[model samples]
Target: MTTDRQISDQRVALVTGGTSGIGLAIAQRLRDDGLRVAVLDLDREEARAVANDAAFLFVGADLSRRADCRAAVDAVTGAFGRLDVLVNNAGFQHIDPIVDFPEDTWDAMLHVMLTAPFLLSKYAWAHLAASGQGRIVNVASIHAQVASPFKSAYISAKHGLIGLTRTQALEGADAGLTANAICPAYVRTPLVTRQIADQARTRGISEADVEQQVMLEPAAIKRLLDPVDVAALASYVVSPAAWGMTGAVLDLDLGWTAR
Candidate 1:
């Protein structure tokens, strides 16, 4: 356990999408782990509320915009003075076949899920390297590895995120920085909850059927994963104990890929 004095000198971490779901859980867990935590989200009021409740530094930025991404990083560094860890956990879902998928939706999804991480990583590179044990954890999904129908944008963004993770890992190696991605199966979050309905409509099934037949059908474990499940793994990934774990794509898939 880190002593109080040590925690006073603790590193700072930034979590994107930290207003809710897996991102929120990871931010809380990192705070519990003695790090100074900053949360970046699109909703300013919600971000402020959560930050106040958790005693965290919060910034709101629509990650789909390049200027917003840059400003978010600047806000974190300005508030915390340095950034030691980054968790790219902001994303959303859109259920539609490729033909029906909106072009604007595709562009927005890529911008937020894929391009935002790239830009944030680019901007935070120097401060992270200065930390001397910098860590970057990309909250990818099992969709990054295997694809289901009607999720082209999400799957594409996640797959690209893994590629970004690898590149960051390689570039950060000499600087004592590390980057890794956690590929989880369906997690219980507002995002996934909303997906249940969208998926049901998309597949012409009832909402109840969507969870069992569609979401968990591929999983060996027939249960939705709590946000804390991902948070716990994230805590480990960003810790000093995981220094050798760069360039890795970790699976929290509940055996979905085993088949």
Candidate 2:
């Protein structure tokens, strides 16, 4: 457990889309590392429970809306007094073939995954600039570097996020804030569970086959990533040791691209 002094001495981290899944893991990991943690999410109850008895604040809001993003950042900075780490990890899979894809869904995906990061970074930039040890870790996917069929919107959003991560890292260099993107292969999350079912229906294959043929085929490990693994990487990137690692995409992709 983090003592009061430890909390005061440690940096403050804002983990977006952190109510559950990978974001939840990242928030908990940082809290364990003695950082004051604030989670931005739509799930008020879940967020509170995740950080219960810890130095955590749950800011309930949707990040896809620009105003909501700004308000969330302000709330976090207000409560913590400074912003040290920003993890933009709130997003979902919206799989569809472009011809029949819903425009509304596409818009939602882009806004949530891409635009929201930009807004949160915008709102947090000044505070981060002042901190001199600020960090931003974007949860971009392996799709940020590679692509698959029937995942147009999701892929595009992840790619755009990589661009955001790079540009922000460069801009923050002189100020000592480091920004980097984590490109992970398929993680075993509820979000990916939904993707499995969707892939089953779309490919007219069993969900089991979706695992064997789709998700695992590209990875050298042939297994789903654990949320903790991704969280640990995010934790490291925000540490002082990662100061020189800005504008980089840290791949936890099980050597998927190596092949």
Assess the local accuracy of residue 126 in candidate 1 as a C-alpha lDDT between 0 and 100: 99
Best by TM-score: 1
State the weakest 10-residue window (summed lDDT) of model 1. Answer: 1-10
| Clash number by candidate, in order | 0, 0
Shift of residue 256 alpha carbon in model 1, Å? 0.3
TM-score of each: 0.94, 0.92
lDDT (0 to 1) per candidate: 0.93, 0.89
Flag clash pairs in model 1: none
Show the lowest summed lDDT stretch of 10 residues, model 2: 46-55
Question: Top model by lDDT, which number?
Answer: 1
Candidate 2 lDDT score at position 95: 63
lDDT of 2 by residue, 1-259 (tens): 8576765667989998787889989998998887888988885675677656555788888877889999998898887788889999999876668998999999999999999999999999998888899999999999999999888999999999999999999899999999999999989898888889988998999998998798899888978989999999998999988898999998999999998
